[model samples]
Target chain A: MASTHLKRTSLYDVHRAAGARMVEFGGWEMPVQYAGIVEEHHAVRTAAGLFDVSHMGEVEVFGPGALESVQRLITNDAARLIPGQGLYSPVCLPSGGIIDDLTVFRLTGDRFLFVVNASRTERDFQWIAEHTRAATARDRSADLALLALQGPKAQSILERLTRADLTRLASFHFTDGLEVAGLRCLVARTGYTGEDGFEIACAWDAAPALWSALVEAGRPHGLAPAGLGARDTLRLEAGYMLYGNDIDETATPLEAPLGWTVKFDKVAFIGREALLAQKARGVARKLVGFEMQGRAVPRHGYALQAEGRRIGQVTSGTFGPWIRKSIGMGYVERAYAPPGTPLQVEIRGRLEDARVVKLPFYRRS
Target chain B: MYPKDLRYSSEHEWARAEGGRVRVGITRFAADRLTDVVFVELPAVGAKVTYMQPFGVVESVKAVSDLYSPVSGTVVEVNAALADTPEVVNSDPYGKGWMIVVQPDDLRELEQLMPVEKYLGLIGEPAT
Candidate 1:
């Protein structure tokens, strides 16, 4: 495919003020980090880190049949969602493969908002609108400003600023109109870090106020303002999936380790029949995490080999900032998903030894 | 920008002769590029380092980069304080954040390094 240009977020000036090193990601000029990736990674692992992810897409699906339409368009059973709950689902293609991984937030009985990845924003919207026979979909990308406050220390930092009892919030649940940092936000206890954190969604103009508030509250708690670099490593460490690299339209959610989100019980949804057939036959390949025996870092699209024969390609690879060892995840034959399978990843013409292991390179107490 | 008293290496390392040994650290330009240094792996004390060889890895929030040794020497000391807190690279990279101390294998090797003005010239920055 052609390389697309990036987009800049509202926090660009704020990042500049904080001395963040900017880099282009999915057409957005975003801070890769202010201090460093590993340091920011360590901070979030030990405490908390702030992330400006406003570049991601937010589409509002409103009308009488909004929830029903979103459910029909995507693979997940969104109709089961009570108001104010969020569910992670994939917009599926006809082949039972994923279009994009998305977060479906049931804001009201007839209104739902979906957050999609930055790079797949256009495609996700097009697919949702085209497939939904019942709902009216509108892209709200220009209106939303998003921040992810993530880590073990996140709850305490948020609790200090918000009037809501965030402790009562469960995973995948959001409470709208919560006051944080003197502004109202649609706060969700969902984060890519796999830690106890919240994704703060607010209006564009209030970005500066929200960013400053987070910084002030985060300072006493060791909350580092992280860039896209630390964000990638942390999400990878958590075994969370990233689109384009991890899975795309050609890779089914079942094959890409997202079978949990595919509700085959949903009658006649997009890709439901194909997914059911695939489920009956079992997936040929599975996504698995691998630990490098050598110091060489594995990068995306690197070749994975077993017994010196290429079996699969690494979809995402990087040094585990906390582990200090090279780690990556990739797809391999289903038989090779078990722990202790020996493999090699080709990095810059050198074959590095890698062994299969369970997902999640780190887990905090 | 280069300090007039400092000698620069193309590998982005800098040295300021302090007594007999040289204090080596990354230049401000290098630190600025690295940004938000999260982890610093300093060379072990007493290790013989070769010119242009990888000495340590400086990990930022986005990527990990090798810190190259600008000159041949035996590492006599390292900044251990960085292990617990690496952001010192961003805070005080020039002084407290010095990466290592080394006894030069050849004192004449220092002559090959660019003087601050020459480094500024090479980087297209007007010499101060």
Candidate 2:
């Protein structure tokens, strides 16, 4: 693999120095693990874990047309969001194909910030910019760094460093220009992990200092430095969709079963017509979670079968560390989408028994 | 931590000669790379294995890798313990983690494998 073209995050040296195993992810040379995937995964579930999510892209849109652009670009109702609130939504093409999944934060009446997937950063920025003539969309991915402190102990650990009243910061709300560890940051009470956590955004060059501060403060709380490997497992257990894997341009939001995210009651948005038509016709296939009956691990691209006939394909699969089961998600025929439906996953040419289960293999207590 | 008494293959399998039979298991370096092995699939007793060929598979939470046989022979014994707790391969890769014991066609084939020092060099471990 020619990794010469891979990008590096601001905390690259810190991860390397800590003996993290680096791998190419979404065009960035990111750490796959620091200690171990399972160990880091449990830490996030039990205690707390810090993550370098700086590889995710950030786009800033501001002007009179900011709300208009956001409402037109995403499937969700951005108008419902007050300033300092964020909502997760899927950016879709006019044909209803998913362009990217991202979170849009309304900074002000006219300014919005979008946190997008790393690989789709450029594409999402171009698409969002082209749709907006009254507003200006600028990609600020290179100028910012994002860190996630997640788990049961996240709030306490973060409180030790920042004076912000975390108890008052509701979910999906952010506090801007907050001083954490003697540095300015934008802290959001949001995270990909299904736990109470914060995603802190800071200047790119200041990331190392923030990381070190969090690591030092988190030591007493049993916090571990997590990587992309643990992040994938964590999100998988949470039943979150990964853009390139669980969703893509080939799969529409309806097929992804992310219908709850689509707001048809709101004004017209991209893919509104196609999605409305599909919603009326009902989706043919729906993404469902399944658990393996045998010890075999179901992997991505594996065939999902029922009665010796192919029903669908596995989009994302993993040995969920916290759940202690082989859990995966796949798009199956709507008839087989029930929680108790029996299914078979083909692994290395051998059919393994599995059962369709409810989404989210694990939840934080 | 390459053991001096064990011979290693380029695939990172360690072999120990015990009379006419050779014990096989992955090295610590390989286990560290795999990390938190969740499941292991091993061949049954009396199964035929070829030298440098995949005998079974080792799966971690994040990855799945093949376990190559270090010697060609009939598998006289297999590690049944790993069927329930495959993480032994990560915790004790060289001792209790031994995968299979094969009665090799010729014990001289063991010499074809690299010595501990050479294997460590191949893995880019600085002399220590």
Native A-B interface contacts kept, per candidate: 0.25, 0.80
Give the range of the ten consecutive residues with the poorest summed lDDT in model 1 chain A.
A1-10
Please provide, for model 1 over A1-365, each residue's C-alpha lDDT reduced to its tens digit, 9 standing for 90 to 100: 22355567888888999988788787788898787777888899889999999999999898877767887877778878999899998888888878889899999998899999998899888887886666788999899999999998899888888888888999999998888888889999899986788999999889889989888888999999988888888889889999989998889999887888888777567888898888999888999999998556677888999986888889998777777767889999888889899999986567878999988887656
C-alpha lDDT (0 to 100) for residue B118 of candidate 2: 91
Query: Which lDDT tens digits does candidate 2 get at residues A1-365?
Result: 57999999999999999999999999999999999999999999999999999999999999988899999999999999999999999999998999999999999999999999999999999998999879999999999999999999999999999988899999999988999999899999999989899999999999999999999999999999999999999999999999999999878898996888999999999999999998899989999999999677888899999988999999999888888888899999999999999999999888999999988888777
Residue A110 of candidate 1: its Cα lDDT? 89
lDDT at position A44, candidate 1: 91
Model 1 stretches with alpha carbons more than 4 Å out = A1-6, B1-28, B31-113, B121-128
Docking class of 2: high
* lDDT assessment of candidate 1: 0.85
lDDT of candidates 1 onward, in order? 0.85, 0.93
